[model samples]
Target: MTDQSTPLAPRQRISPVSRVAEIVTSSPVVLIASIILLVVVLTALFAPWLVPHDPVRLTPSVRLKPPSETYWLGTDAYGRDLFSRILMGGRVSLVVGVAAAIFAVFFGLILGLFAGYIRWIDAVLMRMVDGLMAIPSILLAIAIVSLWGATIWTVLIAITIPEVPRVVRLVRSLVLSAREEPYVEAAIAAGSSTALIMRRHLVPNTIAPLIIQGTYICASAILTEAILSFLGAGINPSTPSWGNIMAEGRIYFQINPGIVLWPGLVVSVAILSINLLGDAVRDALDPRMAKRGIER
Candidate 1:
């Protein structure tokens, strides 16, 4: 007989398929969001191939046609295929949103780390952030875009600037809490450089919050882009973006509601999916909630 104190054989490693299945089952919200995101991304990627008609190709004869077997989602005032325009529009909206979020988060992270870690400049940095926060983000974005001109890069830059302050505040808060941990103090006591302490210790603690914030930034960027486009201060009208689609269609909204309806639906779905997934991620990463989840 084996010794009673001896540990049992190592548990069998989970197969890759089983691991994937487990993740899907455990996080249904994430799975749903992932599917929606994948579809939107793929649609944007394959817009040219997926589109039944050239989105920009104007057909005078078909202008304002209602949803039908031929046009599917119908035609806009310029007689551009709504379906194709919707698919192609996603490319600009998603690209600008995702790009702006990435830039905002990156810039914010660096500034936040500096402000939180270096006591000398904390007050100054926080004051600057507060100043930016005091301004209405949308109004500020519109002003920037109006000054810069309605171009893709301008809109991206405009969107990124307003989002940076939010990210900076989030990262700074995390760094403040993490710096007081015993491990961090011990690292300092062991002659670790400030950079090393921040890189190895503080940075790791901010990941969960950063991920959650990034999703929020992404959703906010999308909405902001749409708002700017609607106001004629974002991307050029020639560029197919969801906001532009709705803006152009609103003129003939009474005659052809599908033009605005389809793009609006896509935007709503995308933002909702991201928010749901963000909540799920936040719940999963927070230790306080982990025990409650298991108990349930």
Candidate 2:
């Protein structure tokens, strides 16, 4: 005596991507961070048009001038325009940060997927990651750069190495957990192959966390590049990097405080912008919070 009139499956829920967008739009912090990040990225991409002067030019006559009408944000010890250098330096920082994070993420994803998929290989790869992690990232980068010689490629490789392990750890764990789920079990029971399962199902689920990690890594990479430059291990002097500017300022810290103050200000703002973007992204990607539509 079954109810023959009605036999129905439950409705499919809203997709997470759509839900995430809706929730993100509701958040003012996310809105502001997104806007600021966009502005910063665009400024970096268009530095030549926006900046008022050549970043690396020297003018001993105008050296250490205070912020004024002609030389806005004043000039450095060599009289290069401070604002122009900051703008130009941002372009380099953005390129390094994004390029390193993306390279690390790509390398990690490939390694992580392999490790997560194959049992015996997982132990070996994770151990290697562990060995790399045991060393302080900054020290490891300096050692590699010293051996390879200081160049943009060397800097990119050095910055990316530490972050790869982090991404691998996150992705591998997520894949392992998802592999045991009921949907995965169902797929395994069906005619689907392992490659199909991983490609079709596993990678998509892990993307949310990967995005969050990428933002954090971008912040870390930028900070690391700045520190390396400060320590004389970064870009060539002619490049006019913020870190280089800071390094130059160190000598004039006592007499001309603007030297340190302006460079430090730009670095802080850049790092802060990245961190804020990360926070907003983390909130948006939080599965529990996203599902509930609760502001967390």
Candidate 3:
């Protein structure tokens, strides 16, 4: 007979959604950062409806006006609404950042799987990856933009290329470690196809790290896009990107400091929030971190 006095251990929660929620709410910094990121992303996504005026519409009459009831963030040298431009500029930055991250991660995952599982191709692929990593990302992006012209597509391509090598390195390392695991070895012994083994046994191991890396890549891509625009090698001047906005505002900074300060502030806040969220994700996904927390 079982001992009546002995109580059963509480069941551990295994739901993925609940786990994600617990991780998100465990830290106040993560919660706040997630909220801020959400707001910024939503605002950017609906910029067309939220903007009170045409971001690119020029008006010479009310140029350099300070923040007021008529202009929430004030008017630029061209008399365009600063608030409108900021909102619209966010769309461009977010799009480039997100798209670049997705593209980099997608391509990187494929290349990394092949290189990690197929030993014959590893050396050749890694050599190419190393060569790309040797160049400074910004300079490489600049060169690409210069060659292709400063369109949104070119800028996206430029940012994605520099970021791919980093993701490839990350995924490759994860796959290398995972491929040696018992499950992977068993799969190989069972005559599973190379793709099947990678997809079923190795890919799952890389998901958490890839998620954290993607957030960082998104932040970096945003900053790089801004820098490219500032240097006149990003999107078209007529387009209102955060970088272009600040670049235009620099010439008249003495007249209206808001022009540069506002966009710069937004960019800084967005990047900070993304980075903090990434950190939170990293902590949540790391078993060592959870063990330390439990010990504490």
Winning model by TM-score: 3
Residue 32 of candidate 3: its Cα lDDT?
Answer: 89
In order, the Cα lDDT scores of the candidates are 0.87, 0.83, 0.91
lDDT of 2 by residue, 104-176 (tens): 8899988998888789989899999999999999999999889998887898899999889999999999999
lDDT of 1 at 221: 92
- In order of appearance, the predictions have TM-scores of 0.91, 0.89, 0.94
Which is the better candidate, 1 or 3, if ranked by lDDT? 3
Q: After superposition, how far is residue 133 of candidate 3 from its true place, in Å?
A: 0.6
- After superposition, the stretches of candidate 1 with alpha carbons farther than 4 Å from their true spots are 1-30, 293-296
lDDT per residue for candidate 1 within 161-266, as digits (tens), equals 9899999999999999989999999999999998999899999888878878988899889999998988888899998999999999888888888878899999
Give residue 187's error in model 1 in angstroms: 1.6
Per-residue error at 172 for model 2, in Å?
A: 0.9
Report how far off residue 289 is in candidate 3 (Å). Answer: 2.9
lDDT assessment of candidate 2? 0.83
Q: Which 10-residue span in candidate 2 carries the lowest summed lDDT?
A: 287-296
User: Arrange candidates by lDDT, highest first: which order?
Assistant: 3, 1, 2
